[model samples]
Target: LILIILSPLYLPILNEIISIITLSYIYLKVKTILKSTQKKDNEELTYSLKTHLSGIKNFEA
Candidate 1:
C-alpha cells in the first residue's frame, strides 16, 4: 500500500536513468563503428599511396 503511494515519485527518476544508459550505449556503439571505418579508410589510402609512389619510381627507371 505504501509502495502504491510512492511509486510515482520513483518512476521519473527510473525513466531518466534508463534513458541515460541507453543513450550512452548507443553513443559507444556509434563511436566504435566510426573508428573502425576510419581505420579501414586510412589503410586503403596508405596502400594506394605506396603503390602510386612505386609506380612513379618504376617509370623513372
Candidate 2:
C-alpha cells in the first residue's frame, strides 16, 4: 500500500527534526552557563587587580 511506503519516510524525517531541536536546546544551555562563568571570572580579576594596585601605592608612600 502507498500508506505503508510513506510511513517509513515520515518516521525518519520526524526523528531528524527531533534530533535538531534537542541539539539546539543543549547548545543554548551551554552558552548561557559559559557566559555567566566568564562574567564571574572577570569580576574576580578586576577585584584582585585593584587590591594589588592599592597595595603597591601604599608601599610607595
Candidate 3:
C-alpha cells in the first residue's frame, strides 16, 4: 500500500517515541524489583537478629 511505502518518513520520530516508552517501562520494572528485594532483605535481617539473640539467651540460661 502507498501508506506503508511512505511510513519510512515517520520512522525517526516513531522510533524515538517507542524508545522513550520502552526505557520508562524498563526503569519502572527495575525499581519495583529493587524495592521488593530491599524489603525482603530487611525482613531476613530481622529474623537473623532474633535468632542470634535467642542463641545468646540459651547460652546465658
Candidate 4:
C-alpha cells in the first residue's frame, strides 16, 4: 500500500525532470547549428567580396 501511494508522486516528478533535460538538449543543438550556419555564411560572403574586388582591380589595369 505504501508503494502504490508513493508511485504516483515519484513518476510525475521523474517525468518532469526528463522533459526539462530533453528540452535543454534540443535548445543546445539548435544553437550549435545556427552558429555553424552563420560561420559558413560569413565565409561565403567574404569569398565573394574578395573575388569581386579582384575583378575590379583587373579592370582598372
Count of clashing residue pairs in every prediction:
0, 0, 0, 0
- The digit string of per-residue lDDT tens for model 2 on 1-61 reads 9999899999999989977876675566556555656757767655655665566457546
The model with the greatest lDDT is 1
**On a 0 to 1 TM-score scale, where does candidate 1 land against the true structure?**
0.60
Candidate 4 TM-score, true structure as reference? 0.56
Against the true structure, whose TM-score is highest? 1
Following a full C-alpha superposition, what root-mean-square deviation does model 1 have from the true structure?
18.4
The candidate 4 region of ten consecutive residues with least summed lDDT is 51-60
List TM-scores for all candidates, in order.
0.60, 0.54, 0.51, 0.56
Candidate 2 C-alpha error for residue 25, in Å: 0.4
| Ranking of all candidate structures by their TM-score, best first | 1, 4, 2, 3
Model 3 lDDT per residue over 12-59, tens place:
989899778766765665565556567577676556556655664575
Task: Show model 1 residue runs off by greater than 4 Å.
Answer: 40-61
Candidate 2 global TM-score:
0.54
Candidate 3: pairs in clash: none
Q: Which candidate do you rate higher for TM-score, 1 or 3? A: 1
